[model samples]
Target: MNPTIELLNSHRSIRKYKSQPLPPGALESFIKAGQAASSSNHVQACSVIRVQDPSKRAQLAHLAGDQAYIEQAAEFLVFCADMKRNTEAAASTGIEPTLGMTEQLIVATVDVALFAQNVAIAAESEALGIVYIGGIRNNPSAISELLNLPEQVYPVFGMCIGYPDHQPEVKPRLPLEAVLMQDSYQEHEQAEQVAYYDQQMSEYYQARTGGNKTSNWSQSMAPMFGGKLRPHMRDFLIAQGFTMK
Candidate 1:
């Protein structure tokens, strides 16, 4: 495999990080790479907030389920799906811009995700480790207020980036056959593929946790699917002007 493919495959979420700060210009370079990511119709509806305040980081850490790495990481950033910029830009040109269309929401959300992933790949290339903190969505309102975000902008997720203090084993993923299909959707093949994947994941969990975690992939996903996971998100997004039409 090429060096880029090797780097991509070796990715691991590094929770523990060193105290060392990033090299000068590194963060900017990574963000530049993120800006280069493709956007829907070139709208580029994304904005990233770099949280540098110690107290704010502490509060964010608490708000995001007390993920200490938010405070500990060398850099913590909140990636936001921002439609306000685009809407205002359009209004300046004398057009009455629409506020909250479902398609607009989708475009902004997908744009930010693509932008952040580009930043991740760039950071990884520089030997920095990163872990995405979706916990920010736990209290998106509080975080939004904390960050002084305006209407038509919402925090999609946060990311912690820093030099790794420890290396971890790369977690296994579902087999290629399960996800990559030819011609069309392969619904009939899923049960067998998932069953095989479940066993593989069960073994991976067992070894990773020294038998303490015996659950498989399907079992582990129970909490997310079984409950109304982050049910407030819909209301919060609506309040942020993304009414989903």
Candidate 2:
């Protein structure tokens, strides 16, 4: 495999970061790399807010489920899916813009995700560690308010970037066969594949935690499936002008 693929495959989320800051101009370069990602119809619907103020970072830390890393990391970035710019741009063309379609939400969300991943890859290449903070969705409305996000814009996620303070084991993913199907959708072997992956994950957790953690992939996913999912997102998204039609 090439160097880029090798770098990608070695990715691990770094929660503990060193006190050192990024080299001058590096953050801009990373954002530039992110901008180079493919945008849907060149809409460039993604926007990132670099949180530099300590007070704001502290507020975000509390809002994002008390994730102290947001305050500790050298840089914290909130990635947002934004159609406000595009909608206004379109309206400027002498036509009233219609917004709040479900597809529009998906497009902007996917655009932000793709853009953030590009930034992640770039940061990793430069020997920086990054951990994505999805907990921002815990209080999306509060986050939007803090960030001053307008209608047609919503916070999808946040990311922490800095020099790694410690190394962590790379977590395993689902088997190729389970995720990659042929032409049509197939799940004939999904259960078996997941079972095997569960065992592998169980061992990984056991070894990583020195027998403190003893849960498989399926077992760990229980909370997500067992009514622990964030249900407030639907109303929050709608309130944020992503009405999903």
The models' CA-based lDDT, in order, is 0.96, 0.94
User: How well does each candidate superpose onto the true structure, as a TM-score?
Assistant: 0.99, 0.98
Tens digits of per-residue lDDT, candidate 1, 82-127, equal 9999999999999999889999999999999999999999999999
In the range 184-225, model 2's lDDT, one tens digit per residue, is: 878688899999999999999999999999899999888988
- Model 2 has an lDDT value of 0.94
Q: Could you say which candidate leads in lDDT? A: 1
The TM-score measured for candidate 2 stands at: 0.98
Poorly placed runs, candidate 1 (over 4 Å): none
Residue 108 displacement (Å), model 1: 0.3
